[model samples]
Target: MVSVGDDAPDFTAPLADGDVGSFTLSEHLEEAPIVLAFFPAAFTGTCTTEMCTFRDQMANFEDVGATVYGISIDTPFTLNEFREQNELNFGLLSDTNREVIDAYDISMDFADLGVRNVAKRAVFVVDGSGTVTYTWVSDDPGVEPDYDEVAEAADAASE
Candidate 1:
């Protein structure tokens, strides 16, 4: 996994912003700090709870001058549906090819679940300079990151 102080891997992928645009991490990094919440899939119970938590606390993230994104291996189409269904306020990114997932070392094999190359539950805070400031990778798929700690990391990154 990419550790704290390591430069965040640059990636450009389709965004679930209900448009034909793509999101480039390096480009966004040039502007402000970023909070990346990587989930295994969209619409799952844990994923929904985690995303809604981010949505509910989006103002805090904005107050700290940070951009928030929820990423998954789901396609943009599916993510668009999930976003609309959940009323998510932030962008959901599609890492369908798992390129970014692999680069971040968050991929897991869910053979029992009949899925492969899915991302593990993880969170990463990247400063404006593109250095990873904080990371949390859950060993259990059902576990969620500490939202308070993630917000604190984002605040620290802004500073």
Candidate 2:
């Protein structure tokens, strides 16, 4: 699993930010602190709430010049709908192949639902230099990250 102080793995994937585009981690390096919020799936109860919370707190992230993106195994098409429906302010990255999840070592299997290799609910705060400054991963998909702590970490990382 990716830990704090480790180099954040770089990957390029489809981004759903009102328009379909490509997001490369390396390209965004040195711009600002980046928040990568990985969730199992979109349009679900916990995922919706978590994403909406981030949307609500986007001003805090913006105040610190931090960029946030939500990631999931859902397709960009589905992610676009999810973003619009939830009024998410940040982009959603599509990891349809589970490459990002595997790279971050946050892959999980929802065997009860026959879903496999989905991203575990994880949050990684990466600074401008591509080093992880904070990380939160939950084995239980229902759990959400502490928004205040994440915001503080991003604020500190910006310095």
Per-residue lDDT of candidate 1, residues 1-159 (tens digit) = 899999999999999976647999988885567999999999899999999999999988889988889999999999999999999998889999999999999998889988998999999999988999999998799999999899999999999
Stretches off by above 4 angstroms in model 1 are none
Clashes of each: 0, 0
Model 1, TM vs. native: 0.97
Model 2, residue pairs in steric clash: none
Please state the error at residue 155 of candidate 1 in Å. 0.1
Q: Candidate 2 residues 110-154, lDDT tens each?
A: 898888999999999999889999999999998999999999999
Candidate 2: deviation at residue 145, Å?
0.5
lDDT of each structure?
0.92, 0.94
Candidate 2 has an lDDT of: 0.94
Give per-model CA RMSD: 0.9, 0.7
Q: Indicate which candidate wins on TM-score.
A: 2
